[model samples]
Target: MMITALANPKRFLDLSRTVSPWTCALAVILLGIGFYWSLFATPPDYQQGQSVKIMFVHVPAAWMGIFIYSMMAGASLVGLVFRHPLADVAAKSAAPLGAAFTALALLTGSLWGRPMWGTYWQWGDARLVSELILLFIYLGYIALWNAIDDPVRAAKAAAVLALVGAADVPVIHFSVDWWNTLHQPASILRLGGPTIDKAFLVPLLIMIVGYTFLFLWLLLLRMQTEILERRARSLMMARGA
Candidate 1:
């Protein structure tokens, strides 16, 4: 019922405009504080040296990559199941942001890997392979949307694929934990409050919050734009006759 109500594009756009400014403001502050503390306050890793600094950005990017895709899948599911209008918009709006985050994760991971692993790339690790696959899935979803001329068919098809790719997220997460991969094990989310020292952990957490808010900010913007574009098209078609 709630989702159906928000299916109206004008409502969604008005809500987005109402909320986006605050979200953007919060994102900037969080990212600023996060990076400042991460780079300056945290002690260098005894082993990885300043290189460990990358974790503050890398881990958060990776988390967002998985998180965004899951959101996309969930919204897509809602769209298909209840025929919720906003659900498809939310799912479609998430793709580019997910892709950007995935790309950031890959790039940062590679940067971190170069010094630590002695190579810029690795194919053997399950985590790495799965992440690469994630990037492809993001591209594929967007491509599918563009390929179809019919909006309803395109959204439904893309939703199905998004749901499928979203399933891969858990598999990727578990692959790292279950398999003997060259990638490092999870540290922050362990049974104990992060295994990391306070100085480093604080900034990493801040960055994660920053990145998450960043996505929300952008997602709202895109969703609003999509609403306006759709409305304009509707008006044009109505006038043409």
Candidate 2:
């Protein structure tokens, strides 16, 4: 019922207008607090020395990469199954953001790895390889969407790819545990609770929250742009006819 109501473009636009500002504001405030706490307040790790600081930025980005891709896949499913008007737009708008976050994760991971593991890029690492593949999937999804000029066909094809590509998410998550990999196992989100110290954990959580809000803010804005572009296209078609 709720989904049916929101399937209308006008309702979706109004909702986007109402929600974007609050999300943007929260994102700014949380990121400010997180950065201050991470850079100034948190203690350095004894084992990792100063390199542990990279986790503040890298961890949230890595989380967002997977989170945003999952969101895209979910939206794609909704678009495919329910034929909701905004679902494909939401998925399309989210792809570049996911790709950006994924790239940031890889770049930051390499930076952290260089100091700790003696190498920036490890081809043998299962987790790293899986994450790299995730970036490629995001790129391919975006490409598939753009390659088709017909919007309906493009959405259908892209949604199928998104659904199929979602299989990689679990592999990416469990690569550390399932194989011998240099990437560390889940620390903050594990069955036995976080082994990380409180000083680092608190700020890290703040950053993660901030990153999440930032993704929402960006997604809403991108979706709004997609909506407007669609409207323009429709107007042009009407005029041409």
Candidate 2 lDDT tens digits, 1-55? 8788988889989988999999999999999999999988888777777778888
lDDT (Cα atoms) of all candidates against the true structure: 0.81, 0.85
- TM-score: model 1 vs. ground truth: 0.89
Name the lDDT of candidate 1: 0.81
Clash pairs for candidate 1:
none
Off by over 4 Å in 1: 172-194
- Give the top-scoring candidate (lDDT): 2
The TM-scores, one per candidate, come to 0.89, 0.90
Q: Model 2 Cα displacement at 99 (Å)?
A: 0.5
